[model samples]
Target: MSSSRRLTTVGFDADDTLWQNERFFRITERHFAELLSDHADHDHLSERLLEAEKRNLRLYGFGVKGFTLSMIETAIEVTEGRVPARTIELILQAGRDMLSHPVETLPGVRETLERIAGTHTILLITKGDLFDQERKLAQSGLGELFDGVEIVSDKTRTTYERIFAQHGDGAARAMMVGNSLKSDVVPAIDAGGWGVHVPHELTWVLEHVEPPTEHPRFLAIDHLGELSAIVEAIG
Candidate 1:
């Protein structure tokens, strides 16, 4: 860790960190399972859909399009190619609905970002399909708060290092705040930046990981409201 880690750059994860995201997925997933209820049980359908999503991540990356495709794939697999065309159309519509769904910024997101915007360089570092991510950011109305907005294919140690260095001082002088311990917290900590986790009510299974309870650079908060105090204390 940098001895002079004064928190120059602040990076926030999108999706469930800044606003609601996973909940929408869960909603659509339920609808998907219902559509396939005749063919498979809910648990079996959910398991298969998750497996498909994990497998197709490399090919399709992360976004509604990829998820819808995975759901369609799962439906076909479960029904042995007997899934109705009407069901497929409904699945496609569900994805479209998600794409157009309203963005709901989490509590204290705007206030905290505004409180720090003038004091420190802030960047939005998120990974997903560029279009959907951009749509959500634009809809969230927090776009102007960010000094830089990076939509990457994925989040990793190198990604954090490169982004923090480019957008602010460097990884050592930066802090990442978000909901996912895997993508938002651990990678930033690994790159020698402070990781402040603001856990959300709901999160995707793939994004869950063991918390870094023993890391000196890691801090976990219950909400975004506490972030300003943490930053001030660090300063």
Candidate 2:
């Protein structure tokens, strides 16, 4: 813990932390690579898409819609605007499939949230399209468990500071739990909040970053089930 005051508020990242998210994107990316094989090689198309996504992160932010748009742009670029209409249709279908996919909550997420809700103020602080994220929350059946939900354009130190300030007094008594080091853990720690990194199996490359090992409040746990114990220990 960074402060003497015990953690009073906990913020959870939605995708890949509480539920299965990146896997769907990965699957769709593979499907996309296959669809564009005539235009470019699988590896080349994959790299181009990733580059496009990164370049458009500012304009598009993070979400399935942004990803879908990036895929379209990448297709056009890689094929020199010669991508077949049928192939474009398949890409759009893949995006719709991702949007409509079932929300699969990760193991122990609901149970852990249920346990901790009794003691702390919980918030779902995730970044993505507002309607899409809200829909996912409704589908996840975990929306009622949170004190509030924030759908933001991006996750950064300033974002965490603002969220904690609004939800409570400051990050002094808050802890952020999520799977992305860049978006969840690092920025939370930078904002003076404790950060717990719960690693996911398939993480997006843009969200990848080295863990802050020397930080006093940084904790890495394999599973979210261990969060209750950490909260208790912090108290």
- Candidate 2 C-alpha error for residue 205, in Å: 0.6
Q: Each model's TM-score?
A: 0.97, 0.96
Question: Residue 117 of model 1: what lDDT?
Answer: 87
The sequence of per-residue lDDT tens digits that candidate 1 reaches over residues 14-116 is 9998999999999999999899999999999999999999999999998899999999999899999999999999999999999999999888889999998
Instruction: lDDT for model 2, please.
Output: 0.92
Off by over 4 Å in 2: 1-5
Per-residue lDDT of candidate 2, residues 24-88 (tens digit): 99999999988988888988898999999989989988899999999999999998999999988
* Local distance difference test, each candidate: 0.92, 0.92
Tell how far residue 56 is off in model 2, in angstroms.
1.0
Each candidate's clash count: 0, 0
What lDDT does candidate 1 reach at residue 131? 94
TM-score of 2: 0.96
